[model samples]
Target chain A: MKKNLMAVLVGVLLTLLSLSLIEVYYRAFVPPKAEVFAFVPSTPVEVPEARLSAELISQIQGDPIMKWRSLGSAYEGEYNAKVVDVSKQGPLGCCVLQGFFAPPGKVHSRAYTKHRDLLYDVHFTFDQRSRRITPEVSHARNALLAFGDSYTLGEGVNDEESFPYVLGTYRASTQVYNLGLMGGSANQTLYEVTKLPEKRLPDLPDQEVTAIYTFMVDHLERLICRSLCLTAQGMWRLNQPFYSLKNGRPYFEGAFSDRKVLNSFYTWFHQSAIVQGTGMVLPPQFTQEHFDFFATMMVEIRDVLKTKYPKLKFYVVMYPGSSDPYGSDLTAACKKRGLNVLNYASVDITGLAQKRERIAGEGHPSPIAHMILARLLNRDLPQ
Target chain B: MLLQEFWDFMRERKKYWMMPIIISLLALGFLILFSQTAVLPFVYTLF
Candidate 1:
């Protein structure tokens, strides 16, 4: 017994001594060499062929070449979205607070892409309260609400070149509302659906509304990811909302909601690179439970919208990555709900970039791709 | 000498089973402290 006790203490001592050596070495070397990181030049992020085409399209359409905008009555003003001040906000504060904000003003500029003769003037506008991109023409009924992330919001393009604008202009009377939020998720979109018009959602039973949801791969991960927000500037934070499944139903959970103590611990844990790299203390993969929660949420969203618009035409446009397994899961879930889905998995828009890979050749369906979708959607609309 | 005596004390007192866990925790703490500054970015590449 005495010998055994001695062995354990010695073992602990040896372990501590070894760890001390490592700590000393790291303390001496790692901090000084922090900036000189080894680069592998490979990105784990893989956009599906269709998604890449979409990105290329988005990029090309944003090209400041040969496009012009007539600043009209629809122009409200230029709104700076970067003023959300990340330095002052907490996790939950960051989540809902950045939802929608429209300041007055219009930005009309004649800009051109790098070394391209594509000169275009873009006039950007937004509703003061809802931040909804006010259309050049607003219609009361037959409202088409385009909801999604940056793709629907036209992240890199002008307001005139956005998909919602193109689709709305497909017919003189089509009233399309651009409700795309940058860095937004299905969770955010669901929140938008819950609070339409002037907060608390529109409850007109007689109003015919068509809500189109654009599906992206990261939307699911973002839905349940608490504190997993990776900003455009590439900063990771222990903030953002998450949705968890309970009793076969998935509900949105605000950041650090119901887990103040756990949040405290994980927030500290995230600051450690070794722990994060181990992947043990981080978010688990998309499990069976997550898939179920995802499917459940879609039903719940539709159920919520159904309360107001019983005659709601809710459609989902699935633009999934080629190798993404979640696309199939989404299709299966949408099918189970008997929802109408337009799949662009087979549409290879990358090849379309081969000709003017410089012009309208690449990224999130270019303006031309938006035009194509507009025409396709027009064919589906009852003429 | 200290390590040897400590081992002898542990043997006498019969506390040999808790060795692995203690060492692992110690290693993790040190590793985390050291690796924090460098690997902050590129977290998206992992998850």
Candidate 2:
């Protein structure tokens, strides 16, 4: 027994010694994956084409770029400090506290690509209620509420060039509310819309409303706290809003990390060198259940909006971007729930100059692409 | 400097068996510490 114990201890000692040496070599000599790839010239990223075009053509189209009042330079520190609790004023709210929003004012910042090319140096203006400013022409009785991730939030572009801004300014009688959050998911939108009647959404006028949700393929992974989503996005998703279906209804389950087992496993998995170094993800194949869950969330969101606005016209616009295997399954599931889907998956930018529809040095859609999409959506709007 | 002190204390106490365990723990601690500064940011930027 004594000899066996000694042998085991020595084995552990040798194993640890080998690992420590490798760690030293990796840290001292090996460059990060990003740095190593930076030397190679980057190729244009593939964005899937949108097939369906808008049918109802309107003559009231203008330049996607509009004007905004600048409130000077905004620092990253000050930007994070201006957080408002959109949920129940707790960490467990339906929408987690997004601290990166500039408080109720126009803030300017610059974005640079890895190649040192200036991508954008623009201003972002927030309204008095801390929403991204969308310029409205006239005080119209109808409302347009936009929701989704950064594409809907217009991350890389000026406020004037965002899809919501283009749509709001183009339509004279509709007031546009930009509920799109950067890196936001259906969880946030569901929570926001559910609480709309409670005055949480203070400025929304009670009238005919049209809610547009810009769907992305990756949102399926986000809906569930997938290992890839948690680790790749880092600590941000720790406090990300989590929801689960109970009796066919979506229930808020606090933050993603609030799930004790998943949080601990992913927290350890992210720190594990083997996982990080190789970029291997867990549950390598997403099953049909994942797609169904995502579609269920959309159903809940639709139901919430319908309860509030009886005449609400909800459109799920699948933004032209990366394609995934479960796209068809997800769309089918949404259709089963009687949701209106404007699939722009085949929206062709092939005729345009290569990469013209995208922002230079960044992957987000350019103002030109936004113009195309806005015009398509304009045709579908009820004037 | 602290590493040297730790080594000295281990030698004085004649805790040879503990040396490997301590080295293993310290090495892991050092690895994780360096990873946070060197690796995590690069991984995050990919998103």
Candidate 3:
């Protein structure tokens, strides 16, 4: 018994020693490259808590139930162009409701390179529901639900510049809800659409409703919280929904924060030498299974909407040439499952390569692009 | 160090049957340490 105990203790110590050595080697020899810290400016720190206005705190505290729902605490009601980034950009423009994340919501920002050269300056606005503000059209007969990431939200553009706004005004009888969120993936769309009917879904008297989900290739990376996505989104994204597919159905496994052990391990792995030294990704490479799972999730979104609105028209629009590697595969999968897919890969919108089509420095579609998309959508949307 | 002590202990005790278990554990440690892709998902299933 004594010999066995000694052997077990030796074994345990050796295992621990091996792990420690590996950790030390990574920490000491494989330091992250300097370029790895490249020039991505984080959101500026909010005013100190001691100096925070009571109203701002109460409003920006975020939703208790949704947990990951609200924007940061620094955002205030009414625009102050100098408020966004006092040093370079002017404050935000007027009117930010109690929604959306800080920095990204209802602010005018000036982008600059490492040497502080001006890039692009623009404003954003959100409604009380945190949804991006799509200007209301008088006597709207139908409803338009626009979903996706920053592109759908009109990240680099103003209130009247989003495709949803143009789409809304085009029909003049459509109530548009811009449900796009920056950094959103299908997970956000699934979550929002799933909970929308349960919450205060907008009442529309129209006989038909059209929902457009703009698919960019990177959106898939965001769904799985790929290393690049996690790195880009930073700390603010921890509590956001993380989903996995189970038995051909997308399952909400809760936010990353909810899984403590995995979160800690993942956090460590992200910062570890194995990734930094080898420049290797931590998440498994996305595969056909993931695309199939995404298609099922889209189908689930369609089912939820169809159950709620009998005359729902759901469309997944893949931007021309943007959804590479798996775009056609996903489109085929969605069509096989009876979802309408519009692939813009072969459709050319003029001035796409020009600075006019993209936000300088930021790369989000400019208002021109949104208008073009709106026009194309208007032409294609079933009457 | 500890590995030497472990090997010495195992040999001294003639508990060579434990060798495979020790090797397996060291191999797992390396996998966790160097694995660029997700290993946590598999590890999570164990819990």
lDDT of 1 by residue, A1-383 (tens): 67766766776777767656755665555532221112112122222343444554555455343243222221122221221112343111223423543343443333233344333333456554444363555555567777776567654356767768877766676567777765556667666665454552433457677877777655665565433333221222223345567676656566424457765565665544433344322343455556556666667677777776787887777642221445556666676777766655444333432222111211233444444455445545442
What is candidate 1's lDDT per residue for B13-41, written digit by digit as tens? Answer: 66674565455775565554543121222
DockQ of 2: 0.03
DockQ of each: 0.11, 0.03, 0.07
Runs in model 1 lying further than 4 Å from the true structure: A1-95, A104-123, A128-141, A195-197, A200-205, A226-242, A256-259, A275-281, A320-325, A354-383, B1-47
| Of candidates 2 and 1, the better by lDDT | 2
- Per-model CA lDDT versus the true structure: 0.50, 0.58, 0.58
Instruction: Please provide TM-scores, in order, for all candidate models, with all chains considered together.
Output: 0.61, 0.67, 0.64
What are the per-model C-alpha RMSD values against the true structure? 9.8, 11.4, 14.5
Residue range A59-130, candidate 2, lDDT tens digits: 212232311222222111111111223332321111243423435776664555444446566667777655
How large a fraction of the reference contact set does each model reproduce? 0.14, 0.00, 0.03
Candidate 3 backbone overlaps, count: 14
- Report the candidate with higher TM-score, 1 versus 2: 2
Q: Which ten residues in a row have the lowest lDDT in candidate 3 chain A?
A: A37-46
**Model 1, total clashes:** 46
lDDT of 1 at A273: 42
